[model samples]
Target chain A: MSKKNYIRPLDIKHGRIDMGHGAGGRSAAQLTEELFLAAFDNPFLRQGDDGASFPIPVGARMVMATDGHVVSPLFFPGGDVGALSVHGTVNDVAMLGATPLYLSASFILEEGFALSELKRIVDSMAAAAREAGVPIITGDTKVVERGKGDGVFISTTGVGVVAEGVHISGRNARAGDVLLLSGTIGDHGVAVMSKRASLEFETTMESDTAALHTLVAAMLAAAPGGVRVLRDPTRGGLATTLNEIAGQSGVGMVLEEAAIPVAPQVEAACELLGLDPLYVANEGKLVAICSPESAAAVLAAMQAHPLGAQAVQIGVVTEDAHHFVQMNTSFGGRRVVDWLSGEQLPRIC
Target chain B: MSKKNYIRPLDIKHGRIDMGHGAGGRSAAQLTEELFLAAFDNPFLRQGDDGASFPIPVGARMVMATDGHVVSPLFFPGGDVGALSVHGTVNDVAMLGATPLYLSASFILEEGFALSELKRIVDSMAAAAREAGVPIITGDTKVVERGKGDGVFISTTGVGVVAEGVHISGRNARAGDVLLLSGTIGDHGVAVMSKRASLEFETTMESDTAALHTLVAAMLAAAPGGVRVLRDPTRGGLATTLNEIAGQSGVGMVLEEAAIPVAPQVEAACELLGLDPLYVANEGKLVAICSPESAAAVLAAMQAHPLGAQAVQIGVVTEDAHHFVQMNTSFGGRRVVDWLSGEQLPRIC
Candidate 1:
């Protein structure tokens, strides 16, 4: 790169991506040095190898998670694809009861995509990583021909370390365990949907896209080994995620519709669009299952965090041979909450 | 998933990916279980969590590498995107002198992509991972609208561990170090190009796509702590990679053109297509820099490996303030081996 110092600087303001940007040549190097490396600067990335090498804490189990973000309208109400990419993977690792340590991002950019937009996304991603205390250590970038790709798609992979005796898995849930929700559902899905449909409401609906590692840490601190399972209801929303947990743990769940929190604006938007709030996605919220003895403490700890201010007990695990998730409606009727049947929305996250 | 066992199995023979497959619904779950899980079956993945948690070797530094595959033709002469995706990231981690342990794959599929083709790719990916002794422990799948994506794009992230006292970096290249080539160059790029152009020859051209971790292990065993730098010349081929190392190490290099190996068919194809072999990518080959004292043993070890049978001494590190890489041509003239200037080929790997 030093030898090519005489080359022209990238025109980030007016330039558009082309085939040369992904050709693995001088142009690609220049883009990396000027855009990605500049934004994701860290000691590990500065090593400038094909990968990043770092020391891990001794005797800790490692957690790995990956996500592909293809949210349309790269810029959304409260978050863009950039921050969503980071938060989505970070939340996944956090849901495994681990502290995220590093991340690797791969970008698939379409030819003719705006460099300015790409820069904005990278900057947002870097900010999100910094806030989450994880660095983007290594990444790869590729460009597809025009019409072959929709602007850009990002895939982020996260690595984290779990402390000793942290046994968290979907199968860990037990009968009589208490189910807790960190916050309202459907904010992320409704926010993105509103943006896509050009729908406007009296009050704006912003995405609840955020990193929940700290909230998980707080819950873990409150009840070290009592928490059974942790999961974020991203796609298929809360209903599908609960069904998955039920099947995994070989237990049924009973949910009280009145207990599950939902913002009035999001509920209204969903009603207008004929979308069920139960099947809507939430980027920052999580469902945690714990013993009855620890549920109070975990819920309190969650409510103390800014991201989990609306935390509440939403349901309970039940013993059922069929592993069905049943919901008691506020109208005094019970119904089976099955997995999301069809496409409620596409590219919601 | 057990509760949803009554759902129809994915029609692997004559189905196309639809919006529901990525909508985080029953269709998505069904596809994941019937296709991805069945093909890349493993205990870690079977945990059925948002992420995979595993214990790492105590007191070893971890290495992470990522690559995105968007090759034009999904199926190439010697490999498809699946095998290429695995070998690419595995080799990147190997170049760091690390033993790869686990992998995570993310797929972006276009709506209307053939399920049969996707199954083939997934099977190939699973085979490659199994052969390389690494498991795809966690993954994500996203589907874009038809015409929004070109068939499919895959991004694979690899995690590895390096033993203590093994310090390998591009900046470690010192003046007077011996440069070694693992085998012939341009096989991967030329093979893919020939397939894309519908060109044929008396001898078929096959991509040299194979995991190099075992070969790297052999070289390390023979020359422990003697290897200075290791790199796979992928995109931009040998010339561009060498120039990158030169800039990073603040040194120059001198190469013997005649010593570098190129297959007869590959050379003929390059000549006929007006392409430079030095700028064509090679997926299975590697370039190693080591002290003169250890070059002989290291070269012998590489040659003993099936992947590096044509190993030879191709160049030597030189001290030059300009950091220029020059080669002595067979015609008795010296030429500067500059970086790849433009897009010679797009989506080659």
Candidate 2:
């Protein structure tokens, strides 16, 4: 603690948030100067404006996405709520084949929360944003009464610029397109569940919460006009996301069970919980639908990326009276993979 | 309920939020389709993508703003959490003289909260957005267990487009500029406090929550480069905001307390609560700094707008050693109006 500074130094070890911290007063400014500004040191944010202003490139179209992360158990195996918040919104913007640029984060903190834990989380988030090349330009922080909120909830909004003539959407899929999986699924959901339940597995399960914009950029570079849709299965997992794509595109999908990538440990955890691996969440994996002609190129590009080493073709699009996503089982049977019917696990972002 | 529809209709009147509502399943889809999609029906949202994509106007720069609303007693006399969420971010973007284009809303729902209340809030938000000529392009919703969250907290991010050569910021306030206020202060804070405390005044106090983009546009049109800075007095109120501007601009401010507009009822309420009117919040009011030569035209333009009928010049920028914001009281005394030091009220927004 510096003797010259008038504001009391925050007891990072065991201090609780008081109402003055969020009252938009001197205490609030101290918190911002001491914690937030120190963590996210960016030029745009240093402008000290309520909102940031920046020049847009010529002929660039803007894409924006917002995701609220309310995951329980702030820390998980391979990720925490902080990193997941950055990855979730960045991936959302990336799904449109846009170059994610700026992000705004709003934190809702519960009083009595630990400052050391908050510092760790904020540092983690800063690292994630730095690694992804998307800066947290501006942000807001609010504290609620101890019992009024969970430990912390973060809502992140990302802004990206997409070049002209680069159109990608879920509705762009067609009957003859191919669906590719960008690695193993269900790691995030399984990891969180295993930690929550204190279940031990032979191999440690880790949440696949890495940012996927770079992977998307690689795929786009390889097959620009051939890519139809890029969706990261988060809350509803792979099966539900595929169904959403099918419904939006008005086509049916047939998946090959043998080609679907799943880690052995994730499968074991899902079995123990009686959860369907198909409906489990994956933070890092993505499903890319592309034209048949470009499928090979896109798959090769995805495989070349570090995040998609296990990329494989998992499904084919088909014409159907109803938009349905069906799976071909290893036993030579077909079952409609519908949207999840109930909550698999809450707060598993 | 329609007999042909297979999905069960939501019990808006008697139902409480369950885990399935936010599980990214069929039930979640049904809730989204029946409630949110039905309320916020727009083309960009109908695309059903993770993020919304849209074209930007040529030569237009992008402006972004985000705010998290966690007001207690979710509903008040003239507004609720919904309308506040829309207006808060919209005003933030508008303060920069940008035309608000789209908004992204994320809701954190507490388990066991009433569905009817949620519907009312969402409908209010939709109405606010529509009236402001801004559509909610995308959104995310999550649910937490009972006792873990307040009924609901909404976080909104707004994207706006600004034309070239238009730059408005707090740092633009220079010595010799005239400071004009849009309208009476303390309405929103008083209204919320009255409701929270169940106070009955002779005349009902109503929140001044409103979208101010059109008003700002009118002022900007009157004198484009003449305007220096525009700021909305929100959490820390007018005095705190002025202090921030002074610090940012490295100039001092001198205010005429008598010229500052305040409703009689609001003043009385503030007196009863032992709160300073200068520190009470005003959601719809704005402080605009402009050259003395252009102050009259800007004030006239602000007065012509519906939200700023009581526009008046209340202060002027001055060259001082400490960049202090001082007020000349009606009693012929001067006092420095410093930043708020402690909590007056929490979650008043």
Candidate 3:
């Protein structure tokens, strides 16, 4: 700390990132101490080791997940790349019914990017991590030439621990399982798209980018071993995630379109853009499959949590050799909910 | 597996990556199964959950580390980005005196890049993981539009475990401790620089990118609690890393330039480029600090390993409030080995 005091402070208000910030030299150290370290200060990071070392609770299974967030417009209506990066990986670990313990982030910044923007993102990330009760214990930063990279790409890795007797996996879904969703879909995708497309919606739509570990904890607590499969419907959205589970579990699914939750604003925006709500990405929402007997308790637990207040049983797993996902439309006709075939939205996180 | 079988085989021979490959849809799944899954097949990855879950050894401390690789030329004299990505994170975890167990990778690929080249990199990564006996259990991928990214950027996170009674940190270095270097410096930096500059030396030099966990294990076993600090001089090379250690331990250092190890070719290349060997990066080398009584044993252990065959005692820690790293040059002059000030070679990692 004393040694760092002698160096000039980073010009966060007016400076832009340059190759020196990533050279692993004095400028890099100065930037790290002034910006990143100041925001992510903790005992593990304070140790100044190449890695962070911590004690793990005995008998707990370890869960590890990673996500590369390349969302366009770094900032959106409800969230920015910083918050999304933390939430995305945190939810992935939570989807395994584990309690996220720590996170590690890697940043690739393009030269000429604003240091002010970088600081804002980092502050958002720090806030999100605090809200999720997960500390980012270690990280690395690099820089690429101006045209060689986007403004910034954040890659986050989350590590968590699951208590004994909790088993969750896509393959754990059974033919008699019931499917539940933790909130409205299409919000994140539509929000980002709206900003990019400059669509004027009747109401402002915000990205549902959030950490779901607490919601997951509540659900797991209510239906301990009954919860079978948990997954966040992200890039490919609900339809694709369902299809993946159906394939993994060797079963088919039947969804009641009317039971699925979608915000009016998001639905209207999707319709206007010719995008199907089912194929739109989500950041905070999740689809869970559990034993039929546990559906009521799980649903009750989810509804009690703020993040999952819109929880509902939207579908049921069924035995089928073809492993198809069919939706019973509100109009009383059934159609195959096929896997998303192409890019509905690129770099949508 | 059956669901993936129906998708058209990826055109690895002539096709290039498209936006759809990272859309998190059918194509994304196909790319993952055909390319990533096939290469990194293991039980943890086969679980197919949002994250990978595994049981940890009881009472063992956990070590987590991450690194972002943005090397130019993609392929260098001895290694490519893929292998470098694996080695870099693995070494970071090992620096904490831990045995690396698992890795998670996140790739950001520029759209329209060749699939064949991506396959080569992934295959090399898989090979490196296998060689190190570590499994890449979880990962993510994103595609940025052309001009928004270089060919590819990789971020890898490593998780490892350390047995009880193993204490290692940069702050552990004491004033009277001895400093040891694993091998010659500047090879990695000079090699990548040569490839980028198209320099034709009388003899080709290869990037010394390698995993140092085995070498570290040998040294730890030999010296036990006597080993105080360990670090790999990757980005800022020997000088910057040493400065960091000195600052962390609140001590100064005196190095014998005649005793330091540097390959003749690397020396000539650095001289030609007007670079200091101390400031040039090395991928496969490390610096260790230990008590004076344990130096013989630690150096002996390092010499026994092929990666550390050129290990030597190059310096000693000294008590100084200034925390300076001074070297007694072969020319009979003493000079302070300062922290690297600016970018010498960007993206040299």
lDDT of 2 by residue, B1-349 (tens): 1111336688889998998888987777778888898999999999889889888745457788898999998999999999999999999999977999999999999999999999999999999999999999999999999999999999999988887767899989889999999999999999999999999999999999999999999998998788889999998899988988887888899999999999999999999999898888778999999988999999999999989899999999999768789999999999998888778878987
The C-alpha interface RMSD of every prediction is 1.1, 3.3, 1.1
Q: Compared with the true structure, what per-residue lDDT tens digits does model 1 show for residues A1-349?
A: 5677636889999999999999998999999999999998999898989999999655468899999999988998999999999999999999999999999999999999999999999999999999999999999999999999999999999999898878899999899999999999999999999999999899999999999999999999999898999999999999999999999999999999999999999999999999999999999999999999999999999999999999999999999899999999999999999999879989988
TM-score winner between 1 and 2, please give it. Answer: 1
Q: Which stretches of candidate 3 lie over 4 Å from their true place?
A: A4-7, B4-7
Alpha carbon lDDT of residue A261, candidate 1? Answer: 94
Report lDDT (CA) for all predictions.
Answer: 0.94, 0.89, 0.93
List TM-scores for all candidates, in order. Answer: 0.99, 0.97, 0.99
**Ten residues in a row with the worst lDDT in model 2 chain A?**
A1-10
Give candidate 1 regions above 4 Å deviation: none
Candidates sorted on DockQ, descending: 1, 3, 2
RMSD of each: 0.9, 2.1, 0.9
lDDT of 3: 0.93
Worst 10 residues of 1 chain B by lDDT: B1-10
> Which candidate achieves the best lDDT against the true structure?
1
lDDT of 2 at A132: 97
